[model samples]
Target: MELSPTERTRLRRLREQGRSDRAALFAVLGAGFVCHLGVVLDGAPMVVPTVYGFDDDFLYFHGSVASRSLAGGQTVCVTVTHVDGLVLARSVFEHGVNYRSAMVYGLPRALDGDDKLAGLRVLSEHAAPGQWDYARRPSRKELAATSIFALSLDEASVKIAEGPPGDGDGPDAALGLWAGVVPIESVRRPPEPDPALPGDITAPAHITALAT
Candidate 1:
């Protein structure tokens, strides 16, 4: 699906790097676990780091029922970014990061009853696949204590910067300094079992598959 751009999606710098594909937006979000949620609490701007999950058109998030960002019918901006590499330029001024980022704009509404539970399940499964089914489900009181919010993915923008360093042909190239791209990647480590678990209990296949 093609992404419909609003004013926010129009890139001023390196406009060519801006993406117009909805699939790219999903790719950036699915590759990362954390997002920065921006909101105005009271009279000041605040950014909170949290986990998020998304389906086809909606992103899900939750926190303690008392969180001000989730209170009322508040409009917010949510951003997810993943650093793919470091662009090492001969000149410090030309250095940059190879990355993918997305910004979503919407008013988040609270989900209750079955919707809340279902939203929570989406969030949990996205962050840690198979755990929702393997672990104990939340109780009535536990669900009551949590506050779930849903934001539409319809009004989102994506920007991706890839490839090697941009200064290879510039004046800085003559300096003889080593300048290229340093690729950055995320790898899963072997699962560390909890100390409190029974000796016979082992890591699930879903968990171990991350390393393979």
Candidate 2:
């Protein structure tokens, strides 16, 4: 399935970076666990950083029941981005960052009961794979205190910028300046056990494997 472009989603500038394929959207979303959720609160724009997870159809996020940002039934824009590298060009104007980004727009629905629990599980597993089953599940009271929301993935857009600088053939190239891509990557370090945890308790295989 291809992404349907709405007026807000259509890329007017740098159209070459825009991606209409659904797989591109999934790739951008799957590469990152954090997302910025944009909404209108009290007629003012608000953007909140939060952890999110997604399956085939919906993106899920959770917050305290009292959190004004998570109050659903209204349209929201969720964005995930991954910076791949820095494009150092001969000229400052040509310098840019290589990145993959996805923006999802939809009206989020508040989840409840089994659906809510499933969403929480997806969220947990997305952040830490296999830990959802390894750790204690949320109790009924805890579940009641949390609010989970699901936003449809039907409306979304993806953009990816990569490769070297784009000014190799420009007049600036004759200026005798170096231009190349400085690669960037996110690395996972060894797990640090909680100070309060007993020394005898070691990090589980699932958690330790991430550092490798």
Candidate 3:
């Protein structure tokens, strides 16, 4: 499951933090729902924050038909990142963030017909499990109004940072300043009912589970 990195995706800054396992990449990706997509349009670089989903091989996301990045057969970079903690070091220069991140590089392909619908299902399932089947399906008109793109996950890079501060053995240790990790976590709060929702329509069990 080791990831075979392409020349463009190779680790340079923090080689020690780079992960070669493909499963590590998938794990980082699967734990998050939103990703920033980077592409170029009309000689200008652009990055769009969008919701995403993935299978074993491809990452899927959607945007408006007018999106400049949605053009067929364009190379794009997608990054998914989760901040785990703040790394406090004895010295200000050594302070950093503990995180898990992945960057994927590939040419995006447009999806249509049955493939498009299936991709949309994957996206919905990723954002909220069981919602695809629970919510009303998208009509043909809705599908026509959206643009879905898929990119292979085969070319990607993964990095992870954890534990306490990294300067324990360095000169900063002699400085005797307090240094440790401030852990961060994503906590799901109770679901807020929509004001217009019918009283008879209750939240589903999957949603209840998510809100815990």
Using TM-score as the measure, the top candidate is 3
lDDT of model 3, residue 68: 57
lDDT of each: 0.86, 0.88, 0.88
Off by over 4 Å in 2: 65-72
Over the stretch 5-86, how does candidate 3's per-residue lDDT look in tens digits?
A: 7898898897999999988988998898999988887778888889889999899988553265567457889999999999
User: By lDDT, highest first, what's the ranking?
Assistant: 2, 3, 1
State the displacement of the C-alpha of residue 84, model 2, in Å, after optimal TM-score superposition.
Answer: 1.0
For model 1, residues 1-212, the per-residue Cα lDDT tens digits are 98877776667788888888888888998997788888887778888888888899899986553266557667789899999999988888888999999999988888899999999999998888998999999999999888878889988988888987788888878898998899999888999999999999999998887773
> Between prediction 1 and prediction 3, which has the larger TM-score?
3
Count steric clashes of candidate 1: 0
Per-model TM-score versus the true fold: 0.95, 0.94, 0.95
Model 3 RMSD in angstroms = 1.4
Clash pairs (backbone) in predicted model 1: none
> What is the per-residue lDDT of model 2 for residues 69-181, given as tens digits with 9 covering 90 to 100?
55735788988989999999999999999999999999888889999999999999988899998999999999998888888998898989999998998899899999999
Clashing pairs in 2: none
Number of clashing residue pairs in every model? 0, 0, 0
> For candidate 2, what is the lDDT?
0.88
